[model samples]
Target: MQNQAEIQKLLVLCGTHSQTAFEQLYQQASPKLYGTAMRLLQNGELADEALQEAFVHIWHKASEYDPEKGSAFAWMATIVRYRALDIIRREKSQQNRSEAMANEQLALQQGEDFFIHELHVDEDQHLQLLQECLKALDSQQRKSVLLSYYYGYSHSEMVTRLKRPLGTIKSWIRRGMESVRECMQR
Candidate 1:
């Protein structure tokens, strides 16, 4: 790893769009940042992604770095840490949703009929209503929502599976949900 002064100087040059300085900065600092990501994410693929994203952020926001606050390495590491944390949070939420779906399926198989008893609605009817609401969505919206909520796919996964941009995937899911909510409310 480069010394703090050298890293700081490289960061300043990167802010000026100096490609050589950026390359040097990346080569010098990426190992430590990758290690930081690996420690936080505990998965090689996720750590790689976090490191890549952190570098992208650092490249764009290099000028925003303030030497008065901390060392350049610390600022870069903070970006990686936050990215890894986001991935962790997203994975946990997906796992929770998957577990809930599994529990609901298990209850149904056991003839518990919790929805009928608790919500005072026939389970079949509830499911049918939801299906109809989902069908009312545009094809892309429906697909996006199903991939995200039913299959518990992260946005990044959806982007890869559906071949859509991240913002587009998010928009489709959001609008799809809003439409479903309106339909259900009626």
Candidate 2:
């Protein structure tokens, strides 16, 4: 767990919509939350979904954080855990659906190979746009985004490999994603 005082500060900043503070909070807290989700759900895919949903909730509800209730990390962890549990429950209720059925549905979504093979020109345009957007990001943001999304490194892994503070890595990825979205919209 991170220092309570520091977590509190970040929470305060998050309430004010400070992206840097939110990034720092995520870096400081996400591993524990992810671990909690994994433990509860026991599936990497479900854990990822829970963590993503928890973060969206956190971003929207940062202002509701109350130190009087518990440490900031604990509060965040609770959210992730609950989200994981909910997903587990939902999955359990849908257990009658076979894995083969799920796979078939997924395959159906990808059944159209036109985009993959026939639309070479459109694919080229998208690839060019992506490259241009990536180029617009700062070096740290670019590297963080690429290493995480392209190479499948977790933020914790990136912290170790990049040898930078977790908060900075989180900030880089967050800002990098925003830049990519904005650029793509253009």
Candidate 3:
């Protein structure tokens, strides 16, 4: 089970879409992949989602695996890591959107008392602070951050929408978020 030869043989069988081999490979590899996902995501629910996506990808992409590029386990682990990262990013974006919407609705409907009661805010001071912080960011950063957090756009979506490199888009979102957090903390 822990042997490279066994893994490579299973991978070959998997390339032909052998159900038994897939099952066995899953049995042999799932625990390690699940552990990796859990470590990266830090939430069981998100980790589960990552693991599911990773397996779906593995099923489809098994034939594409190249031993020259890496070992079967390394290739699979890469898939799992990327999947987990994507899940975490999406979850964080969703959380940010939900919080922003709730804050807006709470401010409009119930005012600072609800913030104090529900969110433990001292006053209504923080309302619009996030918006202002967002406004302070550069255009690309602001757009990337808003698209990602407000609209739940993935990094790839942001890259496509913003017509930017993936690395640049990721940087914009990361830096923009840092700026927003810093501004809100003021």
Q: Candidate 2 has what TM-score?
A: 0.51
Among all windows of 10 consecutive residues in model 3, the one with the lowest summed lDDT is 108-117
For residue 83, give model 2's deviation from the true position in Å.
0.4
Q: Report how far residue 43 has shifted in candidate 2, in Å.
A: 1.2
Q: Give the Å shift of residue 147 in candidate 2.
A: 40
Considering summed lDDT, which 10 consecutive residues are worst modelled in model 2? 112-121
Question: How many residue pairs clash in all the candidates, one count each?
Answer: 0, 0, 0
lDDT of 2 by residue, 1-186 (tens): 588899888987898999999999889888888999998888999999999999999999999999888888888888898899899877764453334334533643686322223335655877668767876799789878877875566787678778999999999999999999999999
- Compose the digit string of candidate 1's lDDT tens values, residues 1-186: 868999999998998988899999999999999999999999999999999989898989998998999999999999999999988998797677667656755765686653454356665776667777876799799878877887778898788777989999999999999999999888
lDDT at 32 for candidate 3? 89
**Residue pairs with backbone overlap in model 1:** none
Best by lDDT: 1
Please give the CA lDDT of all the candidate structures.
0.86, 0.80, 0.80
Model 3 TM:
0.59
Name the top TM-score candidate: 1
